[model samples]
Target: MVSRRQLIGAGAALVGAAAWSRTSAMGLPEAPTMDSAATQVPPVPSQGPHYNPVVTLNGWSLPFRMNNGVKEFHLVAEPVEREMGEGMTAYLWGYNGQSPGPTIECVEGDRVRIFVSNKLPEHTTVHWHGMILPCGMDGVTGLTQPPIPSGKTFVYEFDAKKSGTFMYHPHGDEMVQMAMGMMGFFVIHPKDPNFMPVDRDFVFLLSAYDIDPGTYVPRVMEMTDFNLWAINSRVFPDVAPLVVRKDDRVRIRVGNLTMTNHPIHMHGYDFEVTCTDGGWVRPEARWPEVTIDIPVGAMRAYEFDAVYEGDWALHCHKSHHTMNAMGHEIPTFIGMDKTKVAKKIRQVQPDYMPMGTKGMADMAEMSMPLPDNTIPMMTGWGQFGSLEMGGMFTVVKVREGIEKGSYEDPGEYRHPPGTVAYEWTGALPEAPSAPAGSADGSSLRPAGKSASAAQADHSGHE
Candidate 1:
């Protein structure tokens, strides 16, 4: 067993190496003993046509190999370069090749043999969150089992008896490793999926990071001030949308590993909370809602029928969560007088300008310079204008005709003429005067207009 003191030292060394890896531009350090044989881990065999796997955004499904009757999987834990968006990337420790790792899918009642190879500089262990397994395979380092040291591998074999959405992450030195973005989703499909079959299934994990603008690695210690919120370790414009045909049943499974809860809202449809990490929520127990809040270290699965054909939004309801690289301490300048201050400041610095004086809506249009590898606080484009969003935001494009198993971008939606909102511009009706037998002295006038204007209009009508 590795000592706690040794683990801490090893973690510091790995973090230092990550910083070095960023400056060298050599990318992440190569995992030790990484070769063609090591990279070529056995693949998971297909479970026939009945099994429909979900497509993880900016992620992939893990493959396994069947030995005798048990399914075996090998996961390589190492440093990874995860793209947060188009321009921003982070140095993170994740399973396989990407952050949030890869989706592990299997059928209930099947025995699973998962081999985890740790290539980081620290000791780690994989804890299967919310899974029913024997005490020996629980994966609690220092308790249920020993931790896997640097460059070492460990195997966890168990029989997946329950079917539901689940998650996995490091149980040894959890705070540091998990904050470094080491996590993945484990999905056990029902033995009979046809009983609750859906045409489209999507899975993603909700995670938050505190990487300051212009920096790469996340500050593992800074838990309260997370600036970047993401789904599957990606922000908007880069996060993939869910595309489905009209009238298709869609099930979206979301697992949260962040510090705060997220109320995920979907536009244009009402969905039911069909499942949780524990198990499926019965039809009688389920309730319809437009938004569902998922607490930290929990999972929520939403199901609905895509009856509307258009581009709709899916995002966290918290206003700040939909933004990226946010500065929480910025002074609010709403209704403030900055004209005199700006003029004097411009004399000394030509580029000096006061921003957010009125509001932040206009800032989206300005092409202000940004850091070398940073994105705007809110960055997304649409036909109307800037989306003014960044994290945990994406569109659900429901089209008229889409192939059953095809996963292609449906392109921008074309709105029907009457569906879009437009300004009222036909004609205005004459203002009405007060009734003859009025108890109180009042007149019918537009809400913000003065009484004098109402009198003038009444005189004109007379």
Candidate 2:
């Protein structure tokens, strides 16, 4: 097998005038850019000490060159068109090609030099999140070093002092750059490969965007009110499934770049959080968790054995995070008949559709026409039926016979007889009713008002 450095060197032909003129002039290595949104299998080191490479969901690892006993990498900051999902494309400023730029992996104690070319409209600097290095290499644009001006290239040399989960993003014009999707994972592997070895490892970042349903660029000024919650910039249905061979020990590392926290939940098995952005946890200090809360600007890594054979759900526990392009102004219409109003609206608009009186499940599955360049607020078709999901949701498929090193989808799981949930249809029995007076609160009124007055006040408030 060819070394990743060799394969990346072949991409020198892809270097444009902006990269070639500056990088070659400075004897810098070529920066390889990715063009796809699919999850890529981790690359193997051709002649180096063995280590388990990580799978980047909807992303890839950055390739590095061995130059004079040092690892050399180049990154280009520029605008890119990213496919957030099947039919949605977002224009974002990122490194190399994709938003939440390619994962950068290195081994502990390795000396590394990274050349960064700025092709964006503004100056930017690469902050090594969670990394310990010289004060000058901290990447704070004004404090540690001057910003890398637009159309210029700068280099940062550092040594990987520790092995753990880390990240990189712009420190100059930080808010706008980050809101426009410019961040990536930086992983430092242990020098001893056998230390905490696992069969498969995966990494992704939690990000949220405020792009309108039909827009191509995000609202850089958005502080809260982010509508699209994503894992590695790709929403559900477009996010690739995590495929695992049954009984294989697996590790998943997640970092939160969003403004808020994410409680990432897994269905099949309980796992222990073995690492964080700081460093590895002591074996005696680790704890089991089914859902791990990844705080803003932090990382959490968990491990579990793939003992269950099924299609299990993995998603952010916050309900809104699993939906897409939602509107905050839509009034709840459950149990309210909007037919007469809808009829009146149809006479003038002819395309008015009433909100579902039952629930959004029925509404989301309807064939309502949506805007161009966007998908429904909540959508996905599973083998069973409508998945009714969108952002920050994906399945973890555990199966019996998957080949090692294969990340390909194994299709839907075939349930054994009597293993699937079925609807009840046999007998109807009388059920217990609500306790007396609990329905209207007549028996629990406060001294300030009578039950009738309280009811009237509640009605008025509604």
Candidate 3:
């Protein structure tokens, strides 16, 4: 088992390496490196994906915002634990260190330069899913260029040629890596900015996870049984709600990069399919599409005039992947039990009882009474039924006005705060005194006695 201490050390090392790579690639001063290093600092155990280091690609000198400035961003990836089966752990990739990376927003025609530093061991590259860019700048490992080796840096420079929703992810080992959670959203605004004006916009990157607990790794591309589907890197309720005000025109950029296609169904008013990967479709092409089927490696942009005021559910229509493998309570046959089963059911279903049966049962129990705890048997009715059909869905709440402490009108939508909540109370206190004797630890403390004593002495100052 990997100890918590080792995990923390690994996470710190990864962050430090990523920071160095970004600084080197973009030639930016170490100062004012988007406070993502401060705000979305990795946890001790560092659950989920390590934040893909962010690089400012504005010319040779990287541009950054000052404290609390409007043009600032904290880009990080979220690490996620995908249950391929029971007792297994496969770390999925994410932005802000999350499975679904952060949503990057900018205006069309804006000169955008993004520095991408690989943190994982494998070579990876970020393909600007739908955005049109110079052939050389397009991020295809072998097609456009070689893979960005681990610890190395690559600068993605391009002009936001067209305005619409786009996505980014590793193109190398795509099937496996993407399935494990290497995806995020990229939005570009129009230069003139006229269309169906909107109060708020959200991005959804639909994905699937096949967790096999017995192995601690996510089951990627398993042909037999497909399980666990998600929108924006989470299963239903865990997916987070998009809050909006009534009458607010909201735009949603949906991207599907999984091997399978996702027919995303949104409730309430019908949405207009304004754009596709090929760019803005003709007005004649625009149509009311309630459920849009986003094929792999494709993106769709739509605008919905929020009218109804209520909580709407969004999810995948595929039944099997919607909920954990059907809370089946069947027991596993192992060792002597396996022998007994083999003896009796040799003809019925060979090896029907495998090793992690109990764990599978446990997952079924955990996934039951899907989101809101009100709907039971996610595969049968309501949201559950939608999910079972492999329809990746999420809810849009159209309220009257902007909630308190928010910028837009009440109808303008934003994700609920609890979406990214963390339990910090149980974490090890910020390395009291820092690990003693090490150069880094000593540097963290005043140039004096041991780090421990210095920490204690400086406690009051803090």
Candidate with more favorable, higher lDDT: 1 or 3: 1
Please give the ranking of all candidate structures by lDDT, highest first, separated by commas: 2, 1, 3
**Model 3, C-alpha of 84: deviation from truth (Å):** 12
Best by TM-score: 2
| lDDT of every model, 2 decimals | 0.80, 0.87, 0.55
Please write out the lDDT profile of model 1 over residues 1-462, one tens digit for every residue.
222123224644222333333533542222222111011111223342236677676566665545556766677888887888878889889976678787788888889888888889999999999999998888899999989999888889999898899999988989988999999999888888676788888888999999987899999998788999998888887888888889999999999999999999999999999999999999999999999999999999999998999999999999999988898899899999999999999999989768887789766777788887678887788988898888999999999889876668888999988999888898988887668545656577777877789778888999
Q: What TM-score, computed on C-alpha atoms, does each candidate reach?
A: 0.84, 0.89, 0.59
Kindly indicate the candidate among 1 and 2 with the higher TM-score: 2
Model 1 weakest 10-residue run by lDDT: 33-42
lDDT of 3 by residue, 58-102 (tens): 100122222111222333223444422222234776444345555
lDDT tens per residue, model 2, 268-328? 7999999999999999999999999999999999999999999999999999999988887
Q: Output the TM-score of candidate 2.
A: 0.89
Query: lDDT, candidate 3, residue 210?
Result: 58
TM-score of 1: 0.84
Point out where model 2 deviates above 4 Å: 1-26, 432-462
